[model samples]
Target: MSAIASEVLISRLADWGVDTVFGIPGDGINGIMEGLRRNADRVKFVLVHHEEAAAFMATAYAKATGRIGVCLATSGPGGIHLANGLYDAKLDHAPVLAITGMQETSVLGTGYQQEVHLDRLYEDVSVYDQMVVNPAQLPALVDIAIRTAYARRGVAHLTVPNDIQVAEAGEQPYQLVAPAKPPATAPVYLPPPVRPRDSDVRVAADVLNAGGRTAILAGIGARGAGRLVEQLAVALDAPIIKTLSGKMVVGDDSPYTTGGIGLLGTGPSEELVEEIDTLVMLGTNFPYTKHLPEPGKVKVVQVEIEPTRAGLRLPTEVPLIGDVGATLEALLPLVTPRAERPLLERYQAKMRDWREKMAALENPERDPIAPQYLASLLDRLATDDAILTCDSGTIATWAARHWHIRGGREFYLSGNLATMAPALPYAIAVQHAYPDRQVIAYPGDGGFAMLMAEFHTAARYHLPIKVVINNNNSLGQILWEQMVLGYPEHGVRFGNPHPDYAAWARGCGGFGVHVTKAGDLETALREAFARPGPALVDVAVDPNEPPMPGKVKYEQAKHFAEAFLRGQPHKASIATTLFKDKIAQLKES
Candidate 1:
């Protein structure tokens, strides 16, 4: 029996182990919707409120599972809305497949209604961008798209015309002029174990062995190789500074770790980056050159899967171009173990002091609840195996510093893109992926308000995802950036009052709790976690409280003072809040 191209496409994805697809139904792509209806048992369609959220959900799935996340959208506006989220996947190196619809081929280039050339639109962001004009192209095109997405660790886009979607396909695959066989019969492309050459490994080992004070910078690329990284750290007696993407690579509980680097980093990490003479970068291309040591001052050893990224960030004495785990495994045997790690011990002590300093801010007695307290409380209340995601804002800083990853917990954020409004969608996708696991979201008021409708998606699906909103009613991060850049805070605050998010959650058929007082915060969180269905807790936090950097630069302090002097709004309140924070720290000391 002949099958429609849409069915063929859906079937191909199912065969490749795609169990769920995130998208919304539209008339432009009715045929694909019908295909989904037919294959309901094999491939489940998760209906999202918007195409942007759908793409975000797909990216989240890819990040959490390392599988090719698929999102569907209709032509024109629908496809256009997907750009933001697809870029998120592209920038973060998540393998994602985006399928968008196009107008019927009969219209050609007649400026047909919603006749968007999706292939051209996606060219910049996609690894493989193509439009299907023939039914016979599915078997090869789908395979190649998926394969390229995996190979490049980026997005692949396929646009099917309205007519082409329902076209009957022949049993035989399209013949393409290529050196290799048709991809239809090609087994799923799984990345093979890649290790660096013996000479390169030896060179890297030599650099590490000769260093006086060494440090390891691990990124998302170091994920799944946690044990190997930890072993390497112990062998070298080096401190591990994680990029935000790699926060879970080694738990903050580990003595060797000094948490993160850059603006959202810990005090110990800042010191470690500046003081270390030798730096070993593992599977991370951390871009903050200012936070990194001066190039010629520190000898560098970098291991990367992509050869192009090896020396992209800094000059490298040894560039081990291979998979992080395999390269580290090969190098570990050659590395000489260090006996007395006075530098490592010193940083460990600093890490303890930093933790204490951070912990002191988690005060429950504060009138307007501190964001730090909320983050710390969430850390304590959340399950050991919970999956946590936070929006890109001051919320990220709080999550990075306060939430310590322990047990089987995994954390994700916008990372490189630093985009907002991803946490809720990420939570929904993760909850859908692991129905039994606890999935939580931490988004600020500004971000949550962007894609607030997605809460209904969770409610409609009856996902037991928990959302914790740090209701500060301002663009906290950008506001601070302006102050630090000597500009008065302008158009940063959300006017008047913010919506009652708890009421919105309840309206969407989910559990809701609004906590305005510090004493009520813990009870609301406990209630949200205990809910059987989707729940949201909107906790009012101090808007004036700044997310201070680990090591405040001299220029930053000077600029902040200038901003305050030059008619910054709410300057007195901000000054008072800053003073209270310092007083609390002094009392703790």
Candidate 2:
């Protein structure tokens, strides 16, 4: 007998270099599960507790390794559970493939048990969504789905009916058109990289050359163009401000780097944006419009691979549509180097003073552990080539400000989607992709609780990911937002009977430790990292510590004061403890 269609699908995936898949098994997908069992040596299947986690793992895998990540799920609820994570991949531009099982073709519209409109449900989040109605469509449909995902840099989805998956693939006329090759001799597909036009490059250089003070705002799209970006920054005597997703593009130690821009950014970066005569944006469509300099105030030149996103965020005088590295190379020779460096030096000095103030706040002598202290300690202890995944909320703020990215370290989060609870799943995926490298996760109490079951998934596979929980026992980011908006905090606090996450980790067959004091943080982190399997270090942090905006407006100050006067005096104490170092600067202003 010839190979089953499901087996052929798995073989095609293996041909494209997909060695691992993340998902849970069910009767609806039993055919695919059996195929996985038969192809166990070629492709490994990771059984996650929830389909959402599986989708997240796949998204992270693609983000970490520039390849198409794969995930599978059964019909009905299993397929529906993948929506959130699929949206994460969609918004963040991660290449991923999601395969969901369906009821038999005969029963698909008959209201069969566990039936779901998988194709319709996934349409919004997928770049290519299709349903396989016949066995003859097996390898071709699978191939197209994977290729579309890689080409579009988004999610590709396939809904395979249970009966079609189990049927023999060579029974139809279409199968005879192209004979099935042996599993070991399948073909592979690779998409070509896009390049920029010569005219666009020259136009960008002209815009930069005309400006008196130039600034470069880099994003994740400039990932591999570090050397080119650095060269451009040096030649122009421009200060570089990174978007949160582009934080790893320039190391914290680089003289030209002024740090992240936006709400979770530095004052120096905000100042640089305001002072610049021209803004050269690269590889990032940063969503925070208000945080950017007024569109009318500065001349904008944007470079992006996707032409549609070139000037979507800001009005541009020059939109260079091409690969970041290639465009920068072409634009470099046409531009003249600037001799004056006053603007760059001013921002660098401001950044130096800010770093000094942050260092003063990371005192180990403090009673309750400072979130910044924990993040700083983790940064010091992490390996030179470690991969860090941050969850949404206050944890993102702590990681953004304190987790200094060195040259080799990688840091990422839900950039456009800004979804919570991705830290653990992302860590698990990266650990699986690079078993020899270290993977660390920073998840807040609220985000961690959302997918806490994934801890068991890590232990079951012996992933050895280190999870650091910023246990503030509340929706800390939301609470601060309320104070800034002048709304009294309500329904934001978590009640008693707080979970002992460290103990939970132990129960899930991993090492666990809880640290309340700031002094014990480093030691606990060391012990957790030394463990052979998964580990969780839960650190109780101050719930009142706020993530300050880059520029505080007068209305924001008035609202903050109003919140404090309206039965929230704790905000005053928290502000004093957190902003004491900046008090001198405030007084001067």
Candidate lDDT values, in order = 0.91, 0.87
Query: Which residue window of length 10 is worst by lDDT in model 1?
Result: 178-187
Candidate 1 achieves a global lDDT of 0.91
Against the true structure, whose TM-score is highest? 1
Instruction: Go through the candidates in order and give the C-alpha RMSD of each one to the true structure.
Output: 2.2, 2.8
Please provide TM-scores, in order, for all candidate models, with all chains considered together: 0.97, 0.95
Candidate 2 lDDT tens digits, 240-340: 89999999998888889999988888888888888888899999999999888888889999988888897898999999888789888889999898877
Clash-forming residue pairs, model 1: none
**lDDT by residue (tens digit), candidate 1, 1-589:** 4578889889889988899999987877998998888789999999999999999999999999999999999999999999999999999999999999999888969998887798998999999999988777777788889989999999999998888888885333345575334345552787756888999999899999999889999999999898999888888889999999999998889888999999999988998888889999999988888888898999999999988888888899999988888998899999999987787789899988888889889989887899999999999999999999999999999999999899899999987889989999999999999999999999999999999999999999999999999989899999999999999999899878668899999999999988989999989899889999999999999999899999998999999999999999799889888888888888877
